[model samples]
Target: MKQTTCRIRCVNALVLAGVIATTLAACSADPGATPTTEPTTAESTSPIDRFLTPTESVPPTAYPSATNSEQVANNVVSWYESGGEEQITGVRDRSKEIYSHHAEDNWSIDFSLFFDRSKEAQEYPPIPDRKTQAAWSTALKHVRSGASDIYMSNQLGIVRGSKEVKREAHGWKELAQGVKGLKAIEARLHREFGLDPLTSP
Candidate 1:
């Protein structure tokens, strides 16, 4: 009877241990179903779940188109006739006012005017090569002619002054003296055969 009681107790303990091991194995197997494995890893409380994230593409910005010379000339001429040149020339006239304040007095103004004149000339288109035989020969003349009204006025003044100077200064004695000097000029000097500077005044 003692041997039977001891055997029953041992059997009961072994059965209880087997049941506990089985429960632990089930908890480890299904982590979602059991709190033990679930708490081992952090919970993702995000409102929505994602697997592969979507990518976005950004487009480059484009710049504005530039105005061509023909359009620029048309616009500039229209603006000038509407009193733009008068306004610009008024500002340019005040160049003298700011000249002294600059680092290199007078130098910058001269260079600035030179640049402005060059820039203004390119504002108009060139005459087509097929236009005429004299196109190449007279291109500069047309450019000078088409320049703003103020430049044309200055060119006219220059021509008028040159004519007046030639008329007042030329004489037979002056002509003969210029010719004699041209003949006598030293070959080594490479001096040009041109008008005598003294006779001009």
Candidate 2:
């Protein structure tokens, strides 16, 4: 009877161990199978995906009509004639008011070119004659040079110190010459192009 009882207890202990081992094995992940990963969210992928986004677009500005171009040309001439030259020259005073006025005037002239009329004038039919083209090119060069001179003069004038003030005075002289050169080119451009007179106010 004692031998039978001991045998029964050993069998029961073995069964219990086997059952625990099986349970552990089932709970653990399968090493032979492929590991699954969660899908990536947009926020995580946004930087890489941004290159696929469409570009934002803007509408193009239209060129000005012939009548508007003529009027703009006339206006430019009138502006220059009506003491525009004086306003720039008067920067020699170096007063805050004078500087503001000069800057405003220059900006007005520069901004005017953005109008449709100015675009039309710039896109005017090309001249066939080499001489005429050369003249036009020269005039354009002068206009650019004049604008540079005025800008440089204004910059130099803003420098603080007596020496800078003197330098500013010298810059004013150069600016004056540039203004004259541009005025001359303006006249030539108007006459040659058969547009409204740029020199006549």
Candidate 3:
């Protein structure tokens, strides 16, 4: 009886060892069953990921698309170039139309400069109704000569304007600037104003 009991106990020990070994081997072989290290609950996220994650980022519905700055500036330049009063007026009107299309917090800096020039042109001559050819010439010269400077200034101004517009526009500008293959005026637009001039139809 003692020998039989001892033999039974040895068999039970062997069976337990075999069960444990098989379990470990199966766990290793089965990817789903394998034990995995859990990620820490306090893991950090990237700056970009944090920016992308949506929250209560409510921006104004009337927020104007900041894309029209350069175009409006060019149009103003076109106006001055037309030389014909009717055509110049038409160009100015079109520029106003472009400016009016979106709800800008204020006119873009370049656009504002153009507007001020136009206003000054309207106010030319001491008489309330008299027109001055000299004013027209001066306005055109100021606008044309300062085109590059105005563009650069406006590009930076748009970036400043964007801060007051909406959160999405602000964030879009930040991301678009980081994108590859953007530089010069195009990059400036994307970076400063969130306008993708290259891909827009």
Q: What is every candidate's alpha-carbon RMSD to the true fold?
A: 26.5, 18.2, 21.1
Q: Which candidate is the best by lDDT?
A: 2
lDDT tens digits, residues 60-135, model 2? 1232333655654554334334433332223212222222435344432332232232233234433333344454
Q: Against the unseen true structure, what C-alpha lDDT does each candidate score?
A: 0.35, 0.43, 0.40
* Model 2 stretches with alpha carbons more than 4 Å out: 1-125, 156-201
Query: What would the per-residue lDDT of candidate 3 be over residues 64-156, giving only the tens digit for each residue?
Result: 233565654443323323332332343244333333423564434345554554455444332111122333344344333333232343454
> How much RMSD separates candidate 2 from the native structure?
18.2
Stronger candidate by lDDT (1 vs 3): 3
Model 2 TM-score is: 0.27
Q: Write the per-residue lDDT of candidate 1 for residues 31-117, one digit (tens) a residue.
A: 677354453323553323244244311111221232664543344334333333332333233322222333442222233452354
* Clash statistics: count for each candidate: 0, 1, 0
Report the lDDT of model 1 for residue 172.
Answer: 22
